[model samples]
Target: MRTKDENMRVLVAEDEEVLAELVATGLRRAGFAVDTVYSGDAALAYLGLHDYDVVVLDRDLPRVHGDEVARRLVADASRTRILMLTASASMEDRVQGLDLGADDYLGKPFEFPELVSRVRALRRRSARPVPPVLERHGLRLDTVRRTAHRDGQELDLSPKEFAVLQILLEADGATVSAEELLERAWDANADPFTGAVRVAMSKLRGKLGEPALIRTVQGVGYAL
Candidate 1:
């Protein structure tokens, strides 16, 4: 039974024909949409044509190298999760693989059932709710957790700043005015001349670092 989630597509990049076939077959039986490629170069080419929810990559790949592939994918503007598979079980290898952007690592001689579990994890990660994941250019908000990240680093935000960010995110790129923000984020009864919004915006921009991704609309509120 292919659960609604299990229908997610995956890419398998492995040079060994038998092992790649085995993974593809097992994944298909477990209700995943899978495409298998024999080399790193081929994997990149496949990705150019199809978007996958997850990628099962072999560490020992020809031409492209699994670690490089994972790095490139992570740097790209896509949300594809990668699981690295290999025979080397050394700690250094594992850490290096993770540092290169592999979400999960599986040393070879593993069972099919376990691979299914990791695949599920990868899919979940791809669909994971994020509050600050939405951004235009350099600003992103992790919505689910109410955190912010700029250029891959976390941003420290005050409670009020976070609330203001939420309003902008909910607006979905539409311009929001100060009146609306004051009414929605704070109280209409509060002192508007205190420059509360400006203060918060200043701190937020400082944390985010210029050139600012958020824009001022001249006498209005702000736009993301």
Candidate 2:
């Protein structure tokens, strides 16, 4: 199926810089293109600029305040999903956040893994259902089984390679930027200056031999 990072984007709004950065790092490691803002207003501005799959918002935010941000996002009724966070873990607080149109809620002092899982769940809800299998250009991918075949021959691929290929297939011949590939296939900690994407692409191309299926757009990105 589609991984959390496959074309999925996330916005993290937290007043606390350290916590916000930590959360952003974790989500990025989990393979999401994550952006962080320290205030609710910044979050709103970023939301206006880009379409995100999910937003991890802290209730206690400066500037516009988290509650108002959630309200405005709900009113917009954009496809962006929200996961509200707060130190107040009371039943009433949980109900109130949900009432404000938050797709999910988590209290402060939460586990990092749990936050990642919740974000992924919210992203799945916001994204269109992924097809079980994808086939194009002599390549066939079984998303459910996590397998790939070309010209009826099985292709052994690493997790990163598989993820990269899936993104290209989903693009349907559209050029995918190298930055986009790194965001979706690698973690936030990946060194942007490194040749990680290039190496992985080389390996992938080697495996999917014959007539080149992937084409480089020269500074634009790669298209298949």
Candidate 3:
């Protein structure tokens, strides 16, 4: 049985290069796996390749229009939620975007915190919403607060370590492959063979300590 508590994968589909990178960076810092695309066409292609939990789409995109992209996603019945962003703040624009199948709408010059909050809210309404906190094997993880504790002792963890731990806990004892961990915790630019996952797991185990909860399945993956 697969659990829907996997790390939230996000796509930022904005034509503005700076804004796209900024949003992606912000989301990544917030402990989400993010990818960016500067055009609606590119967004569509990425969507076809990966299953993203949310797509922050810009309404005015180069190559293909954002409206068409939303229509296509809706027509295909994708599980990916759409957060439409536009320069227009008019009620008509919001309604039009919603009618076009966007799950939520945000106007330009918006607050970054609000965007993150909106993304979290949208994700919570997915097939199975994960709690803000996760506990397993005497370890506790606070997703929103960005903190971790093991047996009531506070554990200092880096961003990568925290993300890896989160993914493992969300797996709910299921064996999660290294590729899936990299895909869900790191960005698209991360090289698969860089041993990054191995390094992160080592640090995480050190922080987690004692009982050696994380188990490597040799030819498979890691499970807790």
Candidate 4:
């Protein structure tokens, strides 16, 4: 149910102005809506306020560090897809970033086309058709319907918003990856920096209220 135009939202968290601008322009030219920030703090604030499809993050960011930002995002129920780009190509660094909950880890000097393709792949995984209704932690979800009721209270939800919640509840209290959410909630032609998933989850949390049923697993995904 996603059109080409409907899937273009990207967030770039790179400290270098030239690199950030280049990425932003390239994304725009590729038929995507893009936002670029110079630091991890700015990126996190932007994520809190806006909805995007994917996030392009730099590993070495100022004002909170890219790794910390990634952690915060994972803690967020929205579970946005993150692509960590680092100048370091060390296998250890790659493994660490993946362990830090980034959906994709690309070393510097990566091909632009590969990044774009990865973005699309992440999107497809999120939006694909999967079992919508699921139960966990005493919550019931009818994902496509966007209606949730835990203990008989009618919990209203928007489409993208509920998708985030579904991912958490269906997690069965296990850590669910951000990349997995991207693939399951959107189309393969999705932008990796889009923050829509995060925005949706924020609204969902507001609707649910109290005790925060969703818990953050540090560098891991959300659990019920």
CA displacement after TM-score superposition, residue 4 of candidate 1 (Å): 11
Top lDDT model? 3
* Tens digits of lDDT, candidate 4, 31-141: 455778999889998888666668999999998899999888888855468889999999999999999889898899888888877876565454443455677655777
Residue-level lDDT of model 1, residues 1-224, one tens digit each, is 11112135778898999989898878765545577899999988877766677899998899989877887898895678898998998899999999998899999889888998898777778863333356755556764355677777888876567667766765677777776665444422347888877887778777778787679999777988
Candidate 2 TM-score to native: 0.73
Provide the TM-score for each candidate, comma-separated. Answer: 0.55, 0.73, 0.95, 0.55
lDDT digits (tens) for residues 140-187 of candidate 3: 999889899999999999877888898889888989989888887887
How many Å off is the CA of 22 in candidate 3? 0.9
Give lDDT per model, in order: 0.74, 0.85, 0.90, 0.72
Give the poorly placed runs of model 2, Cα more than 4 Å off.
1-6, 132-164, 174-211, 217-221
User: After superposing candidate 4, which stretches have Cα over 4 Å from the reference?
Assistant: 1-5, 129-224
Order of models, best TM-score first: 3, 2, 4, 1
- In model 2, the number of clashes is 0
Model 1 accuracy (lDDT, Cα): 0.74
Give candidate 3's whole-model lDDT.
Answer: 0.90
